[model samples]
Target: MSSDDHGLLPAELAEAARPAIAEARGKPARDAARILAEAGLTGVCAQEDDGGMALGLSFALAIAEEAGAGQLRFPLLDQILLAQAFAGQDIAGRIAAGEALGVIGWEGARDGLLRLSDDCDCDVVLVPTGQGADLIERAGLTATPTPLLDPDAPQIWLDVGAARKIGSLSGEQMADLRRAGEALYGGFVTGAAANALALSSDYLAARVQFGRPLSSKQAVRHHLARMKLLLEMSRAALARSLARDELGNPRDTRPAFLGAVGNAIWTLEKAIHLHGGMGFTWEVPLHYSLRDIRKIETAFGAGRLARQVAQDFIRAA
Candidate 1:
């Protein structure tokens, strides 16, 4: 279904989300959560009874893009997914109301240790199980921080031995959550790339060398053109992934997600390259986008995801 079919345009939602997301940036986790929830972003896909807007994943995808572009540190994606996943539960209501925070262990299992996206200050974590997933209380788990990539917001490892199960999702619900995650994350990286492209383009246009803008150089122009091309393609791929096929079945999202990651990495790297010496410095914000995209790439195992997509195509052929 199209954005229009949802009775709310994605662009409109994105415009509405930008200010709130920007406000939430650099704030404490709970404060950010309050800002986002008040703006109706944390529960965009949740049930109305749970204090959500009761929208679909497409709306959430728009919000995710805004979050990514703003470099929001909070786990907005996890909050939205969990709120919807746990629909009728009090936890869902709490999450939607910004009274509680939730995160997901994107990798590993509940039997041992699970890997979360980042050092999110959360109240509960959803860990994978044999059937689906269990929402375990964070107070009961031990969190080990991995600050190699992003020291400000590091990846976290959780020891998962018999934490309190506050909620659960069936296998089907987990599958749905995964699909929505792919689409939302695709939107996210695309947004990050878009920001990087804008920053690079603006910088190049204004940074004059030899009495002419650096953007006037053929080689520099070529690089900017390629970045723009890839960014647009990634956006298109993400949009296509969110749409149903002609058979009215959900389209496979792996290709789009993988493609977005690769494209974002390339765009971010090129953006840094275009900035020359300043790109390597902490003063320039381009590296943050690069780091974020790389973290996502590592989390998803882009190489493995691409191979899986290829294998599926080969079998169908």
Candidate 2:
């Protein structure tokens, strides 16, 4: 098998998923989720016993990248990662059926509550703990949606109480889960960057300037080239990280995640610039991608988080 194929989806499965993903784009979030569920894309990495495809993380991440490209406002990552992290097989079954949504809830009690991830309108939230996770029901909590950078990306702070203990995750299990998260988010960044590049390239080609196509200019060509380079490098790094994970190498994944984030930011910015002011307007969707990247980057305390992961990896190594 080729290096790129390491733990990734088989060709048939990828092919089967593509059209469903395309059809889901621009649809309502829950509707899209159901569509994906119907297509069996939602359970790509879920266990076979749970009525899932029994595919691996690489397959999930590949689909996640496609989701990013389409910007199909659904909780694909949460379903694949957080739902699986949950203790009960019932939850897993619900996720595989696309009848439930899962989200990561922050640990600390903010005035007898915790804040969940953006766009988390779901039945349950998995609050990570020192041991495992606390599964909290949405009905038990009060959710107040907050304004965010990307309007499409909604968020909520919860007023919740004690949670039901599920089960504990071993250190190795926790590490693997985190790495899976990294792979999913990395795919998102890759898709966003790739989409931005495509958008900018298309705009430059069709747009006329100085009595000629903007893409005809050498400067524009160079900018496009740089964007392509950043995207490919980030993708390669992410692939390497995933490959390592598949090989049971326990290196920190933060570097690859951060690299993808950086590439997405740069490529999106370039795309906006190349669109020549039109990109900044809400009329165009390019700004939405930029906003999404920025929100995700800062929300995670990205730079500090990456550094800490690197240091931890170094010490362990």
Best by lDDT: 1
What is the C-alpha local distance difference test score of each model?
0.84, 0.72
Per-residue lDDT tens digits of candidate 2, residues 81-110? 754554347887787778877666533344
Residue-level lDDT of model 1, residues 167-256, one tens digit each, is 889999987787788888888888888888888889999999999999999999999999889988988888888888999888999898
Superposed Cα deviation of residue 45, candidate 2 (Å): 0.6
List ranges where model 2 is wrong by over 4 Å. 1-12, 86-88, 106-113, 163-171, 245-247, 313-317
Q: Find the 10 residues in a row with the least total lDDT in model 1.
A: 1-10
What TM value does model 2 have?
Answer: 0.87
Off by over 4 Å in 1: 1-6
